[model samples]
Target chain A: MKMKYYSEAHEWIMIKDNEATIGISEYAAEELGDITYVELPIEEDDVTVGDTIGVIESVKAASDVYSPIGGTVTEVNAELEDNPGLINESAEKEGWICKLANIDVAEIGDMMTPDAYVKYLKSLD
Target chain B: MSDLEIKNTPLAECHKLAGAKMVDFSGWNMPVQYSDGILAEHKHTREKVGLFDICHMGEFRISGKAALEALDTIFARPVFNQRVGLCRYNFLLNKAGKVMDDLIVYRLAEEDFFIVVNAGTRAADSEMIQSQLPEDVVFEDVSDLTAKLDLQGPLAADILAKAGLKIADLPNYFNWTEAVINDIPVLLSRTGYTGELGFELYFDADKAADMWNYLLSFDGIKPIGLGARDTLRLECGYALYGHELTEDYTPLDAGYAPMLKLDDFPEREFTGKAALKALPVENKLIAITLEGRRAARAGADVLDASGTKIGIVTSGAFAPSLGAAIAMAYIESGKSLDIGDEVQLSAGRSTITGKISDLPFYKEGTVRKKL
Candidate 1:
């Protein structure tokens, strides 16, 4: 039940056992405005740490969503196809983009904790 | 580049105070979105009300007996027959049948006229018009001295009437009238780009701040930024000058053939009309809606079932009202694509399925209500 860490790119990983749930932070969603589309990585797609795994497009612009920990995409949220606005309504909750199974915990050290992420977001301003 | 000299409108400070996300738009420091966000602002305009600062647009005044004839020769649309207090949408074309700029002409009097041009194309439009006018015609660029504010929505008239102006007495759609709002002389026009019941207010730029504050003091009125303005217009199938109506695009290719009176007007007498008639249109503008949430953008290629590139998108975005991605593009004519025809849009890494749809992606609008 412990949330692991966050990335400066605005991705958050919630680790439970060897599986990790990933989605953008609320801060990122707010800045990006209305989410029009989410291009999630395919299942069983291998992703390395810091590698781009997906894309999020808003009315204004498109941004790449990066992987915080190296692993293979296990499941992608299919609801995004019809309800992209869910990302804006619940970025870190039901709007979770994908799940990564068999993730390498060693890569978590490279990410920041929730408290550090708050400070990291402030540094951007 | 000296930060590109972000010119400010009179409502620049007001936008900042409203927590708008400011961006540089063609050298003008303008708000792109507000704290309520582009979606909210767009929805407000569609369902209720939204106010916009359009002062950055350029305005010009022309007078004299020769002015009417000079304008008729300069624009692709007829101007001399336009009655006083009425406005007509027209385009300035190059000799090659390409559009130089799309503008609205307001016939102020028998010989005087006011031209409202796009903000980005002001200098070029003014220079082109001036160069084309006869020596006897008097032309003056009045952009710097004028300010424009567009109040648009279903409640626009009620809001204006509450502001001490009797909007009921104003002219009908595509018409204008002179009135005083709180002792401030203003030119009110029942014209807007959002496809909503709206009014465009023209007054002295020096008094813009006062008028802006006075309008905002009312309940349910909010300042909308350029972001919402664009989305609303796109939903209505209105073309953005630089994006859709460019110097390289002709009126025929942009779905303006109905407006062209080629048979009766004669191509030789009008600027660019001959070239337009000669250059057989290779493509036509069409509206498309994606099957899913993934939106196609400008520069995205339109492909046929065989993967052959057929066209390119001019403007695209996620339509808040429609809850889907919509776009406008020019596709090869005679492609057998009709309403409900399936197509594919290639956005680099992925291709999205789309269907040909009618313009004005959003259908629920109160733009042309009968008084």
Candidate 2:
């Protein structure tokens, strides 16, 4: 229920008090139907914007989920390791991939707001 | 990827109205699934009946005085003496003994043959077959002119019967017969990609949309798409073109050497006979059933318990019927794996452990069921 920021690659990030949580947008999850596996990043691992953090394999294809903001990895959704379908069920809430600390809020300008992303998704069609 | 033009099938409009998710499959715009989703569609095909549009597959007509001889010489399997009504699973091989494509040879008559091949390899297979045939052979690429539909599952026959198809006159397994459904002539064959009692109907491309709509009108017949089609075939341990049978691998590597039938037909000489006999089979295809919900996808590295790489996964999917993830891999020849031997697949950053299972991860398919 936080204002979500979406990336052009279809990943969404929710920031609160310098802590950023990230997951793939609903658009991305629906496109990649039946997520069979998700490779989550490790805790304490360093990540930067545009870094390839993990891979998500769906029924159709395997894709790299990129990090939208620069920060230190604090936690990964371990539930995804056993049940990646959680992402398909609830992409925005329980399906959050990872949480990042020490976030560079300046990068938010490069990302799209919820309304802007809605327009962005339509342009893709 | 968008630079290449995507082609639509004759039934594309029907799929659009049915709310199907269209994807570019081998240059043809095809539906990956309808609104029912893959799991529901897959289960429906097992319990009820599901219809699939397979117009993307390539069909060729080869007829001549030496048609059987030309076919036998080109394919790896012995196509000669195949009965007029029976459809024989055949293969085309390169000079290097590698599999070019796996096809079905439908003997319409003594000298006339109907060959069905993969969409991506259609042009290449035509060229290869043409090069080996004499000038008198009539070769026609009917892919553009033909459309195919597969009606599968336990209730397929009943549904087709209700739709005005002569169920009693239907061909036996791997056999073909000319029939009419909704007044449209079709070459009906009791064969399907799904491991179910099914019928593959072929007719004019222009009638595809009409036939598709007509089939849907029957009770318990839902439209299935490629997503369920892939999982259904995988559960049945069927080899797909790009996944299991590829240009880099031979039928022997895919654990289909027994189908070569050299013991029965020792005198038959196919295109890659000498080279195939000369080459050593360095790998064997194994079916692995995972322990959990995760699937080991294609290109995933297969490693032993010690973490040493032993093979590469060719195809993997979550088998809904079995409630486990399954995969087919080409393991090293000398590495032996028992039914319970534990193996790991490097699925991205995570590794999945599984056991080497038998040919069909899911048993009880009605593929060979007699009515």
Candidate 3:
């Protein structure tokens, strides 16, 4: 089963075996309003925990996407180049920003689980 | 304004019920966008119709026999020639020839006029005008008692008909007429910030919710928030109050030389007339369009090809209508830049390449459509 983890910064990472897919959480997507442009990380680029992997510009403001766990960027979502609204439609699935490989699986233990993330979101209110 | 607490419009409850996301705008809690988002709301206004709650804007009624000559001597525009039922966009300049506010003057009758000013500059505008006007003239700030709504789009007329509102004669462009909507008296103007066929309606604040709900109940009309309002105005190259018109810059810098009527009415006298005549034109406002959706927002440094700063962006946005980013910047006067000239703007951690375009980035607006 794929294990989903969420960071305090509102990024979500879905891990299956040793590979993980990362994207912004639905809450973050809604807060940003409409996504206009995104600058993604390059494939084969190594990123550390809390490193800004990309930049997302919305209609209202610009935000940086940070990696919660260290890994190598195996692939970037090419579909977002023309249609960034996919992030607003389905931020967790088809809107996944990037794929990570060669990651330290133990680093994700500090992140929140799906249920824990739900409880954490409630606390924000 | 008496307390530190933020103020809410009379239609606040209605906006919340419509799933609006609220934001603090000039000390008032206003909707930034509804559930449809800015892009969708923007396109809807362009294609269909959108309703905007603009009650936070300030309204002042100036009357008396001396009002006409007094106003003619107050604003940059030649108000003496402004006919009744006509609306004129004018500038309120400080003694230093800088813009205190950009307002609209509506001549209700001979010696009777209504002035609409920006919400943020309401208090200052009131103080300035009150200080300048003769004591015999009557000046009353009726902002609290008034609620303003803008019904904008190509289909705005159809929506007005659908709502069962009647006008003896539809006001011409930049003209206003008194009408009744849902048994409430209103002053309807055929004008808007968006480059679309629209109307601005002013009515009693007590009936704000009723008017908002009654108009939005129509099929084609949807409630648009301030987010789409900003993009819509920017796309049409309209100068926003705080962004494009500020105390730091003179009206001449914002490209209102003709309104000054320095040559047309050389003998005309106003508060800043002498300073405006003496002040050298230092900057010129130019429109720039980017290649993509990344916006070079206000305060971004505009640079030349060699990376030397030449100007600063005043207002910008990712225009939903054009599907690209556009900006208005004030470059140094006599830069010798022509249309289609390439330039650069500074963004976060990078520089965006742009080109000098015409005044309006979007051209197919229906604002001047004939009835």
Candidate 4:
């Protein structure tokens, strides 16, 4: 079964088999106001567990999207280059930012589950 | 203002009732956007009508037999010949000619004038203006009793008519007239910072909430927040106080020397006239459009084609009306950065490459539309 995990920084990663997909959480997207630009990571680039993989610019402010776990960027959502609103629309699904290869299954344990993430979001309030 | 206390506008409760996102803006609790969000509010203002709560802004009154003469000596621009009922954009400067605040002076009558200034700079501006006026000129801070609202867009007049708020006819652009909105006396001015055909309403603070609801009762009137306000003004290249205008830079440094007639007539004298004439343009404000959809916000680094650090961005945002990223920067003089010259804006880690462009990036604005 596929499993989704979240980071305290508001990034979400969905793991299925050997491939993992990453995107910003809905809470992060809403908090960013209106998404204007998304600096997608280059394919075939290596990333650390907490490295800032790319940048996101909203109408009100800008922030960095960090990778939840270290892996190689297999592919990036090229559609976001023209329509960053996808992050605001379906942040957890079609708005998946990038794909990671050579997944670190053990690191997924360190991330928060869906239920824990929801509670964490409330705590922020 | 201390973090322990946040000031609330007269319509703050009404804003919450409409589900607006409240933010601490310059210590005042203000709405950044309503339920429809920034994009929708911004687009509606362009294609339809939008209402803005501007109660946090400050207002002052100066009147006496010698009001004109005293005001002429105090203001950077000559205000003696300004006709009654007309409003003029002016600059209040310190001894060094730097802009203390940019304001609009409304000649309410022969010896009566009303001034509007930025909300954050109200206190200092009031003191500085009071210091310059002659003892005979009566000066009063009307900010506490006054509240401001803006009805802006192409269909602003239609919205007013729909709500049955008639003023015989809308005032001419840059002019104001005494009128009544929903039985509340208001000074209606045909001027706005959004570059849209709009009206600014000045009324009693106590009736602010009632007035807000009365306007929004119209079918197409949307409650816009400060977020869209920033984008709209930035697109028109209007200067924001902390951004394009500040105490450190003179009006000439900010590109208003020629418009203000700073050195045009060497014979005339005003506050800081000598310093203004002697000072050379330091960093010149120029408008630039980004090469892509990425917005280069304020505080970004501006570099020329050869990768020289020439200036820093004062204001930047994605122009909702034009569907492009636009910015204003103070490029240091002597670099000769001409229009159409390519430059790079270091916005965080990524760079937004763009060319020097003219102001009012969104030209379709209806600010000058004749009724």
Candidate 5:
């Protein structure tokens, strides 16, 4: 399924039947350079919109991954522990970091569509 | 920012064209990594070969009758006994035994010497060397006129051999030879920070682009950036200037006490020897390996099993070679931590368990192989 929304923090989320799967965008992974370690949030942890839920470290720098929607984390990708580069290979698909079952539908209003994200990236340059 | 404020290397535009991640490092716009990614570049350096643009490092030339005698007193390492083709690692020290900078001294001749220093401490190192030199010594900061490149890995020798230089003819470890690569006068040294068989080439800054492009034409060579350069070095347990070895830490306290020759060289004759001998070493640098993939980075707190704050991490990263996280830290001396001592590092809400191991984190390196 196509990514339904993107956050300014570089996270992309796909809405599927009221639930959402979230991961950092390919652009963010490319900028991070090398994924060394990831501090994923625990399952069932309550997260607010725009709150830092995890950390991603590259060889050069470290960045926080923010929750794009208010929800409780239902599942986390344990495969990232041994193979963090999956985020670089398939950021929006297989590399999704976590899944939230009860995401707020109104949170989509604060996110950007694919077209707007492309424009946002250009504005950065 | 104006162009006059900082200098750009010949490969600056090339880096931009390749979509490199740029960062302001020591007043230079350096590429931290290219599109291939830092971990891939680091693994390539270990398995095949990797090329690095190390032009940011500083170079200086000292020539005169007093140059030898002046350096003998200025640096911690011995200079008089060094042969013309050899190089020695030495430290520039402050009055209170703190390390100003760690440098490599290339003895060109009895009266001529070349000093390679860190990029961040170039200005201060130059001033310190000049001020300590006798009036007869002639010192020139040749950093602007020179550029350095490091070709490192198991295949480095084969790559250089294809470039028309017999790798065997080059000097052994810590030795250098002045040669011509592509008709550009270059100095090739059998030295590098990565724990691999490598060569460091120094040539005219203007010809850096030609040399860089020439090397990239090889089949297995790729342009690795500063990000990989850091991981490769960190895995080798080499002391980085700002992280492990700094103006505030002495070489002795930075796990180089055995390398120091205070008794043989005599402290009274050296620049900072008196203070170094008088000051008691408070902390000792140690290596730690985490139990899992979670890394504890610089400034992270190191604690014992009982939750006592034992030290602070100086440099830390995930080792691609070992598939584990490793770090270096300075802890209080006289507290014995064996090879398998249990330790924990706290990074915000998460804590990582690790064990004390003697450096380097990765063994089987080809850095000191016999020619």
Candidate 6:
């Protein structure tokens, strides 16, 4: 009933019963070094695929986080407001940025599998 | 520049082996951060000890009968009165009163001197200094053969003693001595970019990797990359070459007018003296503390209370030691702003608010501590 996929932009989306949680991939987080701030997307905002949902600020530079699947943001991780280092600690597991409801499952099929994403990271180097 | 054109220091292979994340810094293949990350490295340097690879910096030797008088005419600071074993922060300026480079001048002897400059401006600095010197002065670039390393923190002295250097024999602040560390002859200087009590060692290029591993072998010392180095210097309100001290601005704009000694020594004349006397300072460099962890990076606009742009940020970062964000900006001299004045910085999609503070957002540095 749960599935995970990764986008070419290095974002990960976990879908379960029409609701999806999103976060950046481990490779992306490692590249960011020490994350200082996370401008979380607002709840109740409608987002489309490939839209810039939020921003991630690291000690080095600022990076835009894009939405992988279109839906309405139902919840945001408020813990990141005070402790943004969570993303650097465990980007994929405990650092989920937001949860979106009514996501189109068809868009999830276009994402790469876990094994494929690992291969994709290899090709980057 | 292309990847093939990027130069490497002597310790590049050692850094790669230590899992450092390398980046291209000023055309040099340098390590920006190690596996422990920038924030951790910064904290470690403040609380413990850290080592840095600084071989890319340029050093020059100028010795002759007129070397002292020749240098006194070239720099904005007085060089003739400088005593042997003392180092002074000096500046080179163009005729139009623009800063060419900020360097350290060491009075090695009455006629012999050592100059250390930034890596990016080495060629230009050499050309400018060589052309201005007298025919009798001998100028030589000794950068390629020199390996530089900085052991910085409160425990730096203790670590040096552990490595076979006598703590009592170490030079005082802003002084240099020819000492032996672990049977290696080095020119050890009691100064560092970080506002910490530290020593910078200069030796043969072949001893880079060995010295790096030797110093870091201590329990208190860790290998820190340039990422933390930038943050540490910024927090201390030190002016970086390309950032706070650029060719587009003069020393007055960077709040270094007092160091120029224009009024203190009326008889002294140096390059750009007339231009500096004629030029009126248009900007005042100020420090600001951000409201939160977000940084106001360089090139970001600083706004007054009514949303009018008043200044531009030159350097910024979330200072790990302070637990808040800090930045240095040059505001219009015409603007009447005081310390603790509220200002806004436009960063990304957010307009973050901050308050103007004094230089050195982080205090309690051990740099001036008597050994």
TM-score (0 to 1) of chain B, per candidate? 0.97, 0.98, 0.98, 0.97, 0.97, 0.98
> Model 2: runs farther than 4 Å from truth?
A16-21, A39-55, A66-83, A97-109, B1-5
Question: Taking the tens digit of each residue's C-alpha lDDT, what string does model 4 give over B1-371?
Answer: 56458889999889999999999887789999987788889999998999999999999999999998888888888788799989999999888888889999999989999999998899898999888888899999999899899999999988777756663577989999887778899899999989999999999999999999999888888999999999999989999999999987888878886678755666667887778778777878999998887888888999987888899999998888877899999888777877898999998766779999987788899999988
Predictions' DockQ, in order: 0.74, 0.41, 0.82, 0.81, 0.75, 0.83
Quick one: ranking by TM-score, best first?
A: 6, 3, 4, 5, 1, 2
Clashing pairs in 2: none
Residue-level lDDT tens digits of model 3 in B199-314: 99998999999989988887888999999999999999999988888998898898888767688987889878788889798999999999888889899999998889999999
Across A6-119, the per-residue lDDT of candidate 6 in tens digits comes to 999999999999999999998999999999989899999999999999999888898999999999999999999899999999999999999999888998767999999999
lDDT of 2 by residue, A1-125 (tens): 45579999999999988899999999899888878778788799888889988888776678999999889999999999878889999999999999999988998877999999999999999
- TM of each candidate vs. truth: 0.94, 0.91, 0.97, 0.97, 0.96, 0.98
Candidate 1's C-alpha lDDT? 0.88
Over B1-371, each residue of candidate 5 has an lDDT whose tens digit, in order, gives 67447767778987888778788888788888888878888889998998898898999999999888889888887788889999889999888878999999999988999999998899899988898988889999999899999999989988887888886687689999988888889999999999999999999999999898898888899888888888899998999999998877888889787777778766437777888788898888999999977778899998989999989999888888888889999988777899999999987677889999988888978999776
- What is the overall TM-score of model 3 with all chains considered together? 0.97
Residue B263 of model 2, lDDT score? 67
Question: Ten residues in a row with the worst lDDT in model 5 chain B?
Answer: B1-10
User: What is the number of backbone collisions in each predicted candidate, taken in the order shown?
Assistant: 0, 0, 0, 0, 0, 0
Point out the higher-scoring one by lDDT: 4 or 6: 6
**iRMSD (1 decimal) for each model:** 1.1, 2.0, 0.7, 0.9, 1.3, 0.7
Where does candidate 5 stray beyond 4 Å?
A: A1-3, B1-4
Candidate 4 CAPRI classification by DockQ: high
**What is candidate 1's lDDT per residue for A1-125, written digit by digit as tens?**
67668988889999998999999999999999878888888999988888888889988888889888888899999998678889999999989999998887888986889999999988899
Q: Order the candidates by lDDT, highest first — what do you get?
A: 6, 3, 2, 4, 1, 5
Scored by lDDT, the top model is 6
Q: Name the candidate, 4 or 6, with the larger DockQ value.
A: 6
Q: What range of 10 consecutive residues in model 2 chain B has the weakest lDDT sum?
A: B1-10
**What DockQ does candidate 5 score?**
0.75
For candidate 5, what is the DockQ-based docking class? medium
